[model samples]
Target: MAVPSGDQKPESYYVGVDVGTGSVRAALVDQRGTLVAFAEQPINQWEPQFNHHEQSSEDIWAACCVVTKKVVQGIDLNQIRGLGFDATCSLVVLDKQFRPLPVNHEGNSHQNIIMWLDHRAVSQVHRINETKHSVLQYVGGVMSVEMQAPKLLWLKENLRETCWDKAGHFFDLPDFLSWKATGVTARSLCSLVCKWTYLAEEGWDDSFWKKVGLEDLIADNYSKIGNQVLPPGASLGNGLTPEAAKDLGLPAGIAVAASLIDAHAGGLGVIGADVRGYGLACEEQPVTSRLAVICGTSSCHIGISKDPIFVSGVWGPYFSAMVPGFWLNEGGQSVTGKLIDHMVQGHAAFPELQAKATARCQSVYAYLNSHLDLIKKAQPVGFLTVDLHVWPDFHGNRSPLADLTLKGMVTGLKLSQDLDDLAILYLATIQAIAFGTRLIIEAMEAAGHSISTLFLCGGLSKNPLFVQMHADITGMPVVLSQEVESVLVGAAILGACASGDFSSVQEAMARMSKVGKVVFPRHEDKRYYDKKYQVFLKLVEHQKEYAAIMKGD
Candidate 1:
């Protein structure tokens, strides 16, 4: 690792590590939030049952080390002033010796992680929801199976011997990463407020825990989970421990900040873009006027306000989860990018389409976009999805609806096995996902949020059609950051805050992040999208009616 030729300050470089669903990524960023180096290593995931997803703590940490080492390969380690981490809200189970504890039904102790997407806790979630506890208000009056409590309850009921008896600690993935780095077992307020049932104003509701039948956690002073909570971007301990430093190939005692959930990091990365001159509602308005959409395998819509607002089916009013001192309202889609992938790749023409894509040196999505244009010309309306519609809930709805049992739907399918049909289906799928976002936006607005601009990041932001569709559907300007991987940049902002380079998280966000492009809603496409939106609602309504009839409701 060598320093570049310049008189740059020693504290210019900061490191940010993000543990995503499939990979661990590391980035070295400067004071200006400019990424100087980046690296990634895939992590392992295990699916032992239909609704179970698990991973290894050892494998994840190893991948983190590999990526951290690679990103700093040609950089000056001494200049690396601070570090921060962000990760999925997956549950990590460990024993008294800090060894992995089996989270699966089988006795495979090496699979220590219970992924956030695992739905084995559905029954538990339903039971918890049935209680009608006051704490449920903060979580949209319905605790999702994706949250920690349901998953913990599932462990207690199903895998009593392997999980319940042996589990000594339950760390949200971000907190686990921080504990590994600094040897501090304190949980992050971001994770607790957003995922776990910790209320910022009243702290843990002991009654809720007891009623849920897992009083052992409360009896133990909640030590196995989290006894202490710190806000995102707060400095953690003195720095990295000697062992963690050795593993990461970095110097000991460098500052390490408390962590954020991955999607919130993307919110911190893009939501503060300078919109004053952009003539958007977020320009001179409070952060509440802007919504941050982190679109990846899933999508999270984050809005912050100084005062808490309780919106049904939205996952917050969590205090200080993203921006400090702001109450966050989190709405999301369980599947966005993943749904698009499934729709396109699962089609009959996939093989021929993929071959055509490769021959043109294009991504399958890109090739499909081009093919969609050709299909539109063949249609009388010159629009690929004029008669087609899709409900983008292949993995269940996460927000506004919050119905995990609801399945996906497709309308206006013809008996054609042509690539044009596939392309139109793809276009319709993308539009459906965007419309889902609109549904969330409308829900938030009805609950008193005046969101006028959307800050988008992640894989879906790279798709022009997707981005434009979001703009047209939501009827708001979409702002994208200059740095494509704003999640990593957001993590780096925490590092900068920890290093004392910035006095506060807000200052770091303002200094490091900048907006690159803006997409305005297309006025001409308004009527088309509106008509399709009505169809989208009808599809869901019809499905609900069918369910009611079948269930004798």
Candidate 2:
């Protein structure tokens, strides 16, 4: 195992900063991986138009500063040995001196970041996919609008004068954070390989760029995007710069690890564990048999194999993208928790549900879970919405179809707008999302990958109903992480690696990440969900037919 040289004292504490869609969070983590203290501050976002989402890099960094200072408040500065970052795979636009540049028509540099959920690049993504370049093979044979290149293409064609012409650097959001801290221009393999179509073995595919009509990127040997790329755990240059050190309230020259996408960080936090007593069938199997579901605003299904497994519509088969020396195949739903929010908040019964939840001192979701039981009246919850079905592609399908043109669909709705209606619709949406997972699993299994377990983390995993629905629907045990904030711990594991406290990322994962509880599949509910899964598939199929008919095809 190759380790960093010139190790001095043992690592005492490391900080992990996560820049999620809604907020920036920092955790002060001990060497044992326990979160000692944490702080969070919500960042700003803008939607100047439809399908557009933007944020400020400067604002995100300021939030990072506030949270980092709070997390390390009472600790000795010297005890903070290293820091790491993980963020949504958003695009950050910058000019030559590393100043922010606008990514939208408003021309405000403060709104420079194009969030991962932004879909302004749909037309650009369609054009890139039309090229069908060989590089597309690494990205599930389709280019998602969420990825960087399509967004880059959009800048070139739409905002050429104001944004693209003056652009000097384009970064995946995580890389931008690392560069901010360390003054390094290097990119992480995790971001580039997974989102930017940079092959780990072959580097940039100039042909793909040229074919897609963005040949300018290759003109100077890919300098505008990135020329130097490092693996996720590798330490970046000279640690924290004096400016960043003062901003983060830390000592100068502390180690900074190359970062991962937030979902990948969640995967690192929960996927690998010694599952001897977990009552999971996968306990004795190889890690390849376990799938990591990092669920929150969006959900990514991360599966690894000793060799490449090319499941259609799933992004990856990328070498060493997540777990080193193994191949990663990531399937995802573009929206999950966000979808739940959209459905519940848009319902007429939302006010009533909110009032009742507040009266019970419970979350709306928690209140709904209990309400679901009452509505079921001794019947299985899955049977309550027997006639209603949902196709959870409201934010566009991310995997197993990779079709962005698809919209959300719901069937079997009545005229009533009561609380019961809201609860059942929420239940059906969660079930639809779970069925989407089952679809991805079926696709992977069809491609010869044997996955027997589901490992879950992130915000949605805290919901017992969501966890149980996944297990009951998939007929696989769902393992939860002991740490609620596994994504932060995963980022800290990167710091531990850079600090030389562990020999490898695998070692760090084993030591810091552990299983909390296992929700096993209920055999009794299996047949019921099996029938519902058939309806789930049919809903999507019928949706496509409706679109065809509407288009007069």
Candidate 3:
């Protein structure tokens, strides 16, 4: 998306900073959700070991400062009303003096953050699930290894001496950003309710904590974790502090909103977009009919309801997690864009494809899409993958199955190593991700969600192939937000709310987000997609069977 013209100015503006898996992006968004200016910076990520992803809080915050300063560069500082932050729901460690603490055994305090994708807590998550606690119901009957409770347990068990014992605060990355801005220790409901096992209606599940053996969290009245919570967009303790203001190149007393997990911010930006007159069935249905799929490196499918609807192996039913006064159910695919990149870049024909793509001034995937069209002849592009199938759980299945033990599987590999093969393989990976979304939708529908449309944003939504594949495979229309960087818009909405420019988040959502384009499902291709989906299911079943046989029972 292009930045807004310098000549056209809105009455007021909000600054949004989003820290995703690999980069930090900041935008200056006007009241209408147009990004006036934007800047981005890459942050550091380390693989201390396999499945053990680590990032430095210092590095992340520095990136945020750099981008923020750039976005607000020529704008009148007085016109900026508020600031908001959104980040991956990773764990941040700090000591009592509010200093970063080592999260790993190597004792490097700089790398105090455990990233959202880290799987070092697998054993802890399994043990937590084994308890069969009541709180599991809210998390779709099983907790994935990615949640904070399990990660905390892992720290206490394995890094007790270096990390856990000295730790005075455990902040979700979103909360960490807010605290840095306003010096407020309160956590966002989006982070606590969705990531930690905090119930909006009844506070922390002390019994669940005690049952999971992380009862030490209970000792300080949950101070180590968050004791006080605020809804996303609520004004935090006196807006940006003096030091933070100087660092971000913003005013000291501007409003600062409590933050949200990055994907939830994306949900807030797109889920409530005004879709009237779009001829979508969702236009006549309740907002709940729309599922906001935030597709980036990974993908999250967020559905909201007036009443709680429990979907097995999904994530929520958490109140006020994404949308206030609405119960949200989140289903997810752990790796969508990442899986596509892995498949494409690892192929033997990657070098040739890259050279051609660079010459055309297009991304490798874009060139691959063009190549598929060139080779498909009379059939659909998907037909290129008729003999090749990919089960895209290279990084364990995150939803519907909720099983991290599950491994990726592929069928139909050929001896041919050419551009045609690479293009088809790329198509298969995108199709596999779309299939994963279909599985998630099926699970949600079985649990009583009346979903009618999909609202999409983030990196993958920009790809026509990915968007069309999802629309065709899911048999639903995909609505693209007028603002491609809808997550930034969502973050800016938080700031708007906190600035009191909008009375409510719902109101801000309505006023800010707008539908740009709608991609309808191709019913003609439905028959073919249906047959492939069957193969997708059978592939998983056969994988489980293979595991059972390998056990030699």
Best candidate (score: lDDT)? 3
Model 2: per-residue Cα lDDT at residue 341: 90
Off by over 4 Å in 3: 1-10
Q: Which lDDT value does model 1 have at 75? A: 69
lDDT of 2 by residue, 1-553 (tens): 1122587654488899999888998998877778989898998989899889999999999999999999988677878778999999999999988999988887899999999999998888998999888888888888898999999999999999999989999999999999999999999999999999998988998888889889999967899899999989889999899999999999999999999999999999888777988677887889999999999899999999998888889998889988889999999999999999999999999999999999999999999999999989978888887899999999899998999988999999999999999999999999999999999999889987899999998889999999999999999999988788999999999888887878999998888888888998888988889999998888888888988899994
Clashing pairs in model 1? none
Model 3 agreement with the true structure over 211-285: per-residue lDDT tens digits: 999888988789999899999999999899999999999999899999999999999999888888888999999
The sequence of per-residue lDDT tens digits that candidate 1 reaches over residues 264-358 is: 99999898777767667678777778899999888999999889888899998898888988998999998888888888889999999999999
- TM values, all candidates: 0.97, 0.97, 0.98
lDDT of each: 0.88, 0.91, 0.92
- Weakest ten-residue segment in model 2 by summed lDDT: 1-10
